[model samples]
Target: MQIARLKTVDLHWSEDGDPDGIAVVFANSLGTDLRLWDKVIPLLPQKGLRLIRFDKRGHGLSSCPAPPYTIDALTDDTEQLLDRLRVKTCIFVGLSIGGIIAQLLASRRPELVKGLVLSNTAAKLGTADMWQERIDRIRKDGIEAMADAILERWFGEEFRRSDEAMAWRNMLTRTPVEGYIGCSEAIAANDLTASTSKLKLPVLGIGGEHDLASPPDLVRATTDLIDGSRYVEIGNAGHLPCVEQPDIYAGHLVRFFKEDLNVGAI
Candidate 1:
């Protein structure tokens, strides 16, 4: 139950493997907590890496401040958390809104991030009007009402039919409405295309074949913004590829660390 108390919020964070090893920090999606990476962590190299993950403000055990959050503020929360952990450099893995945070954080504090793995995300997710409409609907009907439709966007048809999806549904419905809406607002207001285009660090972009939230084309398009970033697509998966296809997702991550970043083996 490690907590990093930032200037404005207390963020719940956890770490595994060697504390002195090179850091690999994971930022999760809008509604999920740090546990989002549970399935993928064990599959990653444990020899020379310290896996770190945190729940953003308003989610998990983290304190909720209020509504109407900005992406920059969310990035600041991440930056502060890392600084508290004394993480001078790291490989950042981000999914969905977490990916947006990665781009902004890398741009603002280039010295802190050594590389990035962007999954099911883009430089700009949706138009303001679209996000506003979604936010309004959630506010009106609550997250539970949208869980079925959201699950469709989040998982492939096969996963949704399985029993495992029930737990995910519970997680989604249990998320604090204020936190979800706040993060939604942050996504609505952010467009990191300009900043992301200027990033020069090693990057790997991943998307799922059945992902409707941020499709493969959009993910690849964001990857192309970086000068030398590589892109891969996972089959039989949707937005949360890490959840549905941990083996393939982890394989790409391991390859990126070894081949692209020249990291040592497990």
Candidate 2:
């Protein structure tokens, strides 16, 4: 739980595995923290992977400013973290808004990113009106007002029946209102279609078969933008596949490192 005190925000982050190992940074989605990747992290082979997971600004233990953060600002926060840690090379694994961040990061700092695993995200998330509606609800009724709907979108009925699902639900509701609201605003404004398509590095797009937020088609469409990129849709898992299907999700990432990037080749 070290803090990277950037100019805009102080990020809470954890760097695990060997320092000399290849850097693999994990970024979380909306309404969740670094802990979102907890299940999937342990499942990853630590032999030659230096895993980095962090709470984005305003999420988890990270410092919060106010409402309405831009995607550029979010990207800046990530860059600062990487620079501060002196991470020379990385394979960024990002989910949802974090996936968007990965796209932006690769475009902005190609030297830093060697490959990517983008899961459960799109070029553009929701329309401005939809984001506005969510913001209105949060401002009026608070985060609890939208917790149930978010859970439904994040996980399926079968997952909802378990204690793990309940735990995530609580995590969603506990997320700072400003954090959720700011990220939502950024999602509404962001469109990484042009930037993502230009990336030539090895990429593996992971989509959840049951995902309602970023459906399989949506994920595939984004992957298609990048020439030579590959796609896989995880079965039975909803939006947060890493939570509901940690083994499968982790397997995909390992395969990406071993096969796609040939991580040991470095």
Candidate 3:
């Protein structure tokens, strides 16, 4: 187990593959922990890569501060964690809220991130009213009430019928309420469209064909803001393509890391 004790929070983090190789940091979606990348990590060329994953301030085993967190605060937590870990430069892959963090972090500290993978996310999610409504619903009925609906948005019909779907449901419902709400508030008040449009780094935007949370067209629209960014949509998948179709997800990642960024394996 590893933890980066930052000024505001102690982040739960892990590193895999070669410790001495170039870093490939992963930031998971809301309501998920570092294990979100379990299936995708091994598929990447590990010889010259240091794959890093971590839980943000609220989710996973990390310490949750309180509700009504800001995206700036979330991005700071990630920035502090990376600085504490001495990650000078790396390819950052972020999903959902994690993607917003990536955009904000890269904009704030351009030197820290060389590449980005925005997966199933957009510069701006739903409106504040929508998020507030969801937050209120969760506050009243707990995460379990929204689990079914959220799962529906996260996975396609085929994957939802499988046994693995139950585990994802558990992961969702078991998420700390304060953490979920805190991150929800942070997301509610964020709009990365302006900042993300200014990013000049190499970017790859990935969306799931069946993703109701972040549709392929929405993801493509954000990717189009970048001068030379590329967008790919995974078929028969929803928001969490890494969980439903890791092969396709990792394939795009490996190609971006190798061909686009020229990251070589030993």
The CA lDDT of each predicted structure is: 0.93, 0.91, 0.91
Q: How far is candidate 2 from the true structure (C-alpha RMSD, Å)?
A: 1.2
Per-residue lDDT of candidate 3, residues 1-266 (tens digit): 88888898989999999999998899999888888999999988878999999999888889988777988999999988888888999899999999999999889999989999999999998889999999999999999999999999999999999999998899888889999999998888888888889999999999999999988999999999998999999999999999999999999998998888988763
Summed backbone clashes in each candidate are 0, 0, 0
Where is model 2 poorest over a 10-residue stretch in terms of lDDT? 257-266
Instruction: Return the candidate ranking by lDDT, descending.
Output: 1, 3, 2
> Which candidate leads in lDDT?
1
Instruction: For candidate 3, give the lDDT.
Output: 0.91
TM-score of each: 0.98, 0.98, 0.98
Instruction: Encode model 1's per-residue lDDT on 227-263: one tens digit a residue.
Output: 9999999999999999999999999999999899998
Better of 1 and 3 by lDDT: 1
lDDT of 1 at 77: 96
